[model samples]
Target: MQIFRQKHLEAVYRRAAEMGPDVARSVELQMLITPKAMGIFKPGIEVIAPVLSTSRKEAKEAVRFIDDSPIRHLASITTPLIPMRTSHMSLVANVTHFPPDVRWCTDNIWIDAPVNNVLPGLKHIADTMPPAPNHSLRLNWQPAASRPDMAFSLESNNYLAVYGAWTRPKYDHKYENWAT
Candidate 1:
């Protein structure tokens, strides 16, 4: 029992020692990107969550004291805004590293996943994602009018293979009806 207690205490001490250096490094990195350091007066929520400050010093200190960074370096430094469709949006996105419990409504989605381990990839996820029973979002696939023929033959056996599909209405689970 004493040995177990000592082992736990040693582990806790080791972790605390490790965290001190890491936190200092994080604070130093924060200093580099601070509004005062960058001479940025404009309200930019891109780095840290926007805090209203009268002076640069306050902004710097506020930034240095930030305990967590849900927003990553990718969205902050370069290509500040990469616009997406209005229907879906997520601020804190680590697509590769999803939360333990990531649930997707699939009333509209006809395909049932065999198991959780054999889940869909980014491309397959769209097919599995549920659309509204009434309002089914569709991406019409018509070749560009300007460049109808760049170099490829527009001949295919499948309708969807050549031309994009018009989305059908989703299924309503509550009503047990296919909404139009």
Candidate 2:
């Protein structure tokens, strides 16, 4: 994991604080655009998912579960959001880093699951297993966002944290264009 400099973290927090409580509690999950969607990978399609966890250990476990499950085919890639202090308010900061202005919420995993399988899979997962360690896995789904453009405009606009992905072989080629 890349350690964010103190100044950068403070900036993010400062901006987040200005959004107020409703926005902070409302923002959850991170948005993702696949390499193909961004025109980086040929023959790939855009897929999005809520951020499962900021914790590397927990995120890895969720990915492992997906890789070992039948739904693995629906998942394209799992990426990390810029790490932030784990707090409800920080969710606002986390989401400030995506595009397409929108506000809604859902507890269901929102990755690239096909329309046909999404509901059934969500039901099955809800019925069979407890929530993930971070409690990210849930049945009731709601997404929220107010001012998303602030994410791209941040002084340290490194939202995706692509540098920390270097250890994951699957993401190696996908993020070449994002190299600093």
The numbered model that scores best in TM-score is 2
Q: Please provide, for model 1 over 25-83, each residue's C-alpha lDDT reduced to its tens digit, 9 standing for 90 to 100.
A: 21211111111111222212112123335565654554442333322221223322222
lDDT per residue (tens digit) for residues 1-180 in model 2: 111121232222232223222232223322221222222332222222223464766655543422343333343343343444558535643442232332222232223333343435323322332111111121112233333676533221112211112223554454333322
**Candidate 2: C-alpha lDDT:** 0.29
Which residue pairs of candidate 2 clash? Answer: 104-143, 105-141, 105-142, 105-143, 106-141, 106-142, 106-143, 107-140, 107-141
Clash pairs of candidate 1? Answer: none
Go through the candidates in order and give the clash count of each.
0, 9
| TM-score: model 1 vs. ground truth | 0.17
Local distance difference test, each candidate: 0.25, 0.29
Q: Note each model's CA RMSD in angstroms.
A: 23.4, 18.3
Q: Which segments of model 2 are wrong by more than 4 Å?
A: 1-36, 39-44, 52-54, 69-180
Instruction: Return the TM-score for each candidate structure.
Output: 0.17, 0.22
Alpha-carbon deviation at 168 in model 1, angstroms: 11
